[model samples]
Target chain A: MPTDKEHVHNRIAVLRAERGVSRRDLATALGVHYQTIGYLERGEYSPSLHLALRIAAYFEVPVEVVFSLTPFPRLGSTT
Target chain B: MKGTTMEPTSRKQKAEALREESRRRAAERQQRRDEIIRATIDQEVAPRWASRAGRRRLVGLAAGLLALPWAAVVVCWYLAPSDTAMWATFALCLAAALGFTLIANPLMKVTRGVAGAPDRLLDERQITERLRAQALAHRATLALLVAASILVSTAVPDEGNVATLPSAVFAVFAIALLATVAALPMLIAAWRMPDPLPDDED
Candidate 1:
């Protein structure tokens, strides 16, 4: 049997903030309830591949830039 | 050109009017749907459903509501407190069981976890969560039925004559079992659902 769902870290919050797009707006664009956007931003829910792609498409970015297995580096931190 | 000239202007006007009326009605329907959706979300965000502590307490209360009746039946059967005590117990327990089942069905609606809710009522995430909850509830309900069967078997003699058991006892078990089975999916979903994140400046 497969393991429990692993957390899929995402940059959705950062991207939404940078774009000045409200969670409601993003949720509407993605055809999900606004709370779902919050869940995605908090890494509590891992979106399906279709939803992930749609979210990325909404922000005009690749899915990789939006979601990753590893956490994204802290903003402005040197590697 | 001859056909166009022959067509009645009044008939054309009536058709246009009908189309306009239909459009207006459709818009009104959409507005009502949006309002209902907003109301439902607001209810979900209310303190009773939003906070973990509150939800846990409610789930526990719902459980106790059913268990209390079941326990009373068992006690009445064993102690034979009075000639009509078992019947009385079944009657009272039946009321409470029905009450809880009624409340539970609606509570699931607020959480969008009602197994019978139409697909349009839930989003993808909620749909996925509900499906998982129902699957778990199905397995749990099976276990409960198995346990109940074993307990009821004890009441039967080597003759396997269930008639020896008071018919009232059957009523007690039936109400409790039916109510539990009906409410299991809702209870399971409510208990397993995580508290929604506090609304931050969203």
Candidate 2:
């Protein structure tokens, strides 16, 4: 519906930790290299919408829950 | 139909079973290949060339690699050594080239997300990196070729005079430049690639 090439911050590491999924397992499930998982978590590599959706699906959460335009707040901090 | 040993339903079932087996085997093969790719990244890309220092060292080495052929050409230009010595020099340079490529190519592949990989095999991020690297390499190589061509043409002596550089040296230079052309993209991509994120759990 809209477009922006800027970075899309994600909470992959937090989600992965909460879900107890190793980077290797997540990468294997997503059909990408493990280092890609690392890159994505660190906000160095941005995923396409398709890949973003796939990742959201893998985590069984809404896409918004995984990705957001603004920086996600610290996990335990009161906003 | 009356004479047939099997009914149509049984034949269909057998065909489905065969198709299922084929699908299973294909998936199995894909999984195995994925494992190999993951292992290669873990061992080669992960263990080597991940540091800023290591990457910088390799980038410097890549510059030397580009200069390598030119160095060989210069040697031949200055001193047309004995035939045996010339051959030995060629052999040594060849070995060095091979060794350097073997060490550098993995880093390039990681940097460029499977450098030169086909479209189907690469993800969006990989495709972008590859395209950017290739575009840069193409422009750089074209400029180098043009400059070299101009220099060589200007160096050609007036009609009927002896060439300043030996014909053999020109041949060697051309060959070396050709190899450098092939190696340039990988080197550029490798140099431009950022150091990968740390491996620690985030």
Candidate 3:
């Protein structure tokens, strides 16, 4: 059922890359297995509301910056 | 000069060394990713019973419950006064059914599902496997029932006295029915487990 729904595009991979954070490192910080981080990064899994908030808190960013229904704008590109 | 020969060979060797180092690092990264994936699957996919110590207790309880009725029936069959044996068998069956409803059912409630119901502890993939297994079990049961019906109907005498059939025949049929019924749940539960990932040959 989760798979049937539209994917919730995310900036997790970009954010992790910008921070130079490996999946294992992020997973450790979040107290989840590394593959869960990989899944989240690839948009294969949608995090629960609680987990989304936790991830945003971990990154020191707002939830909207991390996840969105639409694709995020390219970094440093003119509109 | 000797220097020209040495310089070209040295350049080729350096190039080869760089390629090897790159290949090794690539292999290391792939191995790390593989390990992470395996760990995640091992952590999340296993059923509660698979990793939990409480499975042993649950198994012991189920085995004891199933065995109790058979033990009673066997003791009654051999030890009871000849006249009471049949009545004892009937009584034992009734008692077992009562015990299952009153005791074992509630004890098993955590893992319990109606024949086709999804187990709460199972993940989506496991639930899919369980459903497939349940369907197969249903089909097998249906086949068995149909075969039994045909055999029974054919074995009945032309006189139409169903009671005239041998009691041993009925007992055999009852045992078959009981075994099939008992196995269905166990089959589905066992089938729900994911297969181990096959080793990569390369």
Which residue pairs show collisions in model 2? none
The TM-score measured for candidate 2 stands at 0.70
Evaluated on CA atoms against the true complex, candidate 3 attains a DockQ of 0.02
Off by over 4 Å in 1: A1-5, B1-38, B44-49, B68-94, B105-117, B159-163
Worst lDDT 10-window in candidate 3 chain B: B193-202
**Model 1 interface DockQ:** 0.55
The TM-scores, one per candidate, come to 0.73, 0.70, 0.36
Candidates' C-alpha lDDT: 0.73, 0.73, 0.59
| Candidate 3 CAPRI assessment class | incorrect
Task: Tell me candidate 2's fraction of native contacts, as a decimal between 0 and 1.
Answer: 0.33
What tens-digit string does per-residue lDDT give for candidate 3 at B103-153? Answer: 333233323322223254333333444566668878878896897679657
Expressed as tens digits, the lDDT of each residue in A1-79 for candidate 2 is: 0235687889999999899898879987987867778888878778888999999999999999999999999968999
Which 10-residue span in candidate 3 chain A carries the lowest summed lDDT?
Answer: A31-40
Taking all chains together, the TM-score of candidate 1 against the true structure is: 0.73
Per-residue lDDT over B1-202 for candidate 1, one digit per residue giving the tens place of the 0 to 100 score: 8777768886888999999999999989987876675555445444565566766677777787768667766766665556667666866687676767666544654464444455576677878877887899899989988987897676655464433555556666676777777767777777776666665564
What is the DockQ for all candidates, taken in turn? 0.55, 0.34, 0.02
Model 2 CA lDDT for position B99: 63
DockQ of 2: 0.34
